[model samples]
Target: MAGGEETRKSTDSLAQESSIIDTFAPEARFECPICLAWLRDPVVTACGHRFCRGCIYSWLEREHACPVDNMKLDVEKDIFPDNFTRREISQQKARCPYIVRGCIEELSPLDVESHMIICKFRPPELPENEKLRCQFVDVGCTDKFEDEPELQRHLESEVTKHLSLLSQAYTKITISNQASTSAIAQQANFWDPPAKNEQVSTSEADEGVNALLRAMYEKIVVLEQKSREQDIIISNMSEQINSLNLSMSKMQLRHCNGCYLWYINDFKNKIKDMQKDHHLMFYSPGFYTSANGYKLCVRLNLSPRDPNYIAILIHMMKTEHDNTLEWPFSGRLSITVIHPIESYRNIKETMMTRPELEAFKRPVQDLNPRGFGYTEFVLVEDLKIQEFMRNNTLVIKVQAQPV
Candidate 1:
């Protein structure tokens, strides 16, 4: 009976595969359904369909969709250029043969073969004058100029800004080193506590002041050595923990259905780092609600408007299933900042999607231009939420579902 069930399942999968194969032609990817020929200036619809530009215009004039699927297709809102398909078809047929040899040119398929014969061979590398970047790029100067004169002019004009960036970088390094030293000092304090002088005054007098000082000095030396050893061990342990955290971020702890948990490591340090680079953002790994469901990830950063709070935003990323998903997403998002030690103390915030707002609209770019979320999710120094972080790590859980 088990063997029969397995055979039936295998047979069902093969039948479905065969049906899909029948729906597409040998080179159906490049062929338009209406024109019965290779595609020319193709445009894709949000219905997970595409057509030649000329054919789509003709079809949309008569009805709102292609004759085959009849699914709704709007020219103004739903249609977009399929850049992948465009590049694939263009390069395969019209690209110059010497592009690999550094010939930066493309021609129509009819004229490509003849043009290749006359094209000159270009050197592998371009001249330095053709491309350049600021020398202070290491310290975070991201500016572009048209030419050498423009770059020189920018350098002359922005002397103060560049010097300030260098100073900030140096200051950050100093603070980081000092923080590490203070942490070691705290550990040493934990291991050694002073004797209660009130009760032991007479006992210390019997030992003599000079002799007692020598003993105390010797003990301090031993404790310092021991602290150094412990610091090395802790440094190694921190590296291992960092590697594990990276793995967890890339591939979550387990498969999720419609919820995701993001771990923000070194929370306090991140809050400090935000002061140096206001645009710095932390993105959680991407996840989906279900199979062929909405793809999303959380964007977190110190609130731009008010640095006292952190901003949490959700973005709708482009996926293969994007064209088929509902637009102006109607759902309720339940976001929670989980307490590391106590479950009951978790901070939960809820927001429902507003159809009138652009934040929940279908994505046009790789990630939607508009993100839906709270600007000030929580206060940075709230006493009740201080315990939400453990071992300097903060955890956030986000759940999305239809309203």
Candidate 2:
């Protein structure tokens, strides 16, 4: 009879403990689709279905999608519903699902979101500024920045404003220097005579006066020569300034896609007489065909912009066709003027391949295309003429040529 009573007492204690546990634990709405275990903390998808946090995360990892409907679950953007009220449930509660996997703690549904986001077990964020972050975060920038506003400022800073600031600063310094020079010249008393002028005897005066007169005459001659040189320099500079102004005022639209062609033309026409004809051309004529059958031909527009030796157009080519093309073989075509040609007669002969030749062709445009231009050019190598064509947009560089 005593052993029977002991057994009944033990059974009653076990039932009471079970009841306490049931009271403290949160009621689960669904099972984790992945682990087939009771859901600990549930997350709601944009599509309004609930799933275990771990199950949803695993699904996203496999193929960025919701478990039930395959809707895109941008893990970063998905909203995790709050379980703040679940924390108020009694202490005899069940442990979090993650507890068995070494996360030995319980978290309210509300706190689970914060924990999951910063969870070390979770995938490490790709060093921030990753395209996977927020929608506004995935810009074309390869470099990672700390925040959005900083990146925005960087993109907004265009080359034009940078150039303008530099130009303005240069102008400011030039004006300040000129002002200082004018002030010094105005302050100088050039006519002041020395006290020694009153102390000389008649003969000494005559000899000294004659010497002084000769010295003054020599000084006058030197000053006049210097003045003439200064005038010549000023005239040359003025003429250059006027020519530059004229060039700037004459805004032109060039059909030739070669950005450097006009510059080469200016070298040949305006500065040709100043160059030496004996110099050799650096780049020889060549042709290149893209994967899409767009052929490009390059040749010497052999000329210089000044009296010195330098090829005005480093690479110049014209294409034979226009329209859509893939990249590497696509994007904007540009000619990099490696050397500033100062004179027309200096030329250097060089050899190039077909693709290399095409890489430097001028862009072309379709007149119907809202913003573009067209160009046609030929390659002349070894006295042989080959035709090439392209229709790409022209982006004329209007900024002052850099020194």
Candidate 3:
């Protein structure tokens, strides 16, 4: 009687401490046998047992057996539920069948679904098996995509990785075309002259002809343009050379002569006379006497009455040959008239003796002129002669001997 009474009290206390009615209060609820968590999508086995979705899913992974009675279970078999008894049982707390402890408070019907998914005490969510028979199970993919169709849809419509690939292919093609064109140009440059009898197909021959014509036309155009430009440059250079020659031909007078003269003829004979009389001092001391001397002197007879009284100028003018002229120095004629006082006195004596001769002779011959005059010329350097006038001239001036 004592043992029996003690058992009754213990059982009553156990029932009071954990009752489905008190834990769940007003709604249907249950704990999973495998995980000791609230039942979500609770399903019954063939043996009239129930468990949570995740708990059973995991248990089925390794061994298909019921946790409570070790009853053999078939996954393919549909779960048959007794809803009337489940509703009644849901109102009271039942002892957790799990080997581990479960939630202290019984779960409400609404919370049961969420509880099973994340319950720490619940068995691990099973790894899906993708064997031929398990078509619905997606093993390695964890994208929240349920099936192959969803994964395929995501890859094709959303990602469109192939479009990027096509763009890359087109870029590669463009680069290849440019490289091929460059290579062809380089090869053409490197090709040696071909043999006359090289055989070629009709199509290849036509293509080659077209290519050659195009290249030849381009080259011809370039050459023509270059030739035209070069011609213009040469013409301009020639004109400049001519102008420079003309400028270089200009000669400055050394005697401070205000006038300039250009001789159009050779004055070699007149020049020889001037040298013999020593009237023109420009000849280097021994130049006229040299064996090879071919010096030129020009003489122009001028009456003191002539509007241009340049006798002394002729004496003072410096001279140079065109071939020997240089920059800053020019071809000019210079004459130095030596008026010896003794000769003038003698002439005076003779004139005084012969009145007739003296009548024709100018008394000034015995006297010195009031002042002297000089001549100037324009000439060029020897180096620039070829560029100047093609022909040269010289002039000579001879003073009349005193009557």
lDDT of each: 0.66, 0.38, 0.38
lDDT per residue for candidate 2 within 43-88, as digits (tens), equals: 6778876666777777788888776777787888885753642233
Q: Over the stretch 1-403, how does candidate 3's per-residue lDDT look in tens digits?
A: 4554445444433443344224333333356667665565677888877776667868987888887788777777835554654564466443222212233345545454456445554333223321111111111112334443454575566344545543433333221122212333422422311211232343333333344444555678999999999999999999999998765543222221322233433333433444455434232111111112112223343223431222322211223332342222112223322222222311100111122322222223322122122332221232123222223333222221111
- Top TM-score hit: 1
- TM-score of every model? 0.37, 0.17, 0.22
Worst 10 residues of 1 by lDDT: 189-198
Model 2 residue runs over 4 Å out of place are 1-403
Instruction: Identify the leading candidate in terms of lDDT.
Output: 1
| Weakest ten-residue segment in model 2 by summed lDDT | 386-395
lDDT per residue (tens digit) for residues 1-403 in model 1:
4554445444433443344223323267877888765567878888777678889888898898756788777778878888887776666544444443346575654345457447674212222233334545445566755444666899999999999876655444321122222332323222221211112232222222223333445579999999999999999999999999987754542247669888888988888888678898888877877767777889988888998888999987777777888887888898999987778878899888888887778777778767889889998887235677788888999998865
RMSD of each: 37.6, 36.1, 42.7
Residue 8's lDDT in candidate 3: 40
| Angstrom error at residue 215, model 2 | 6.9
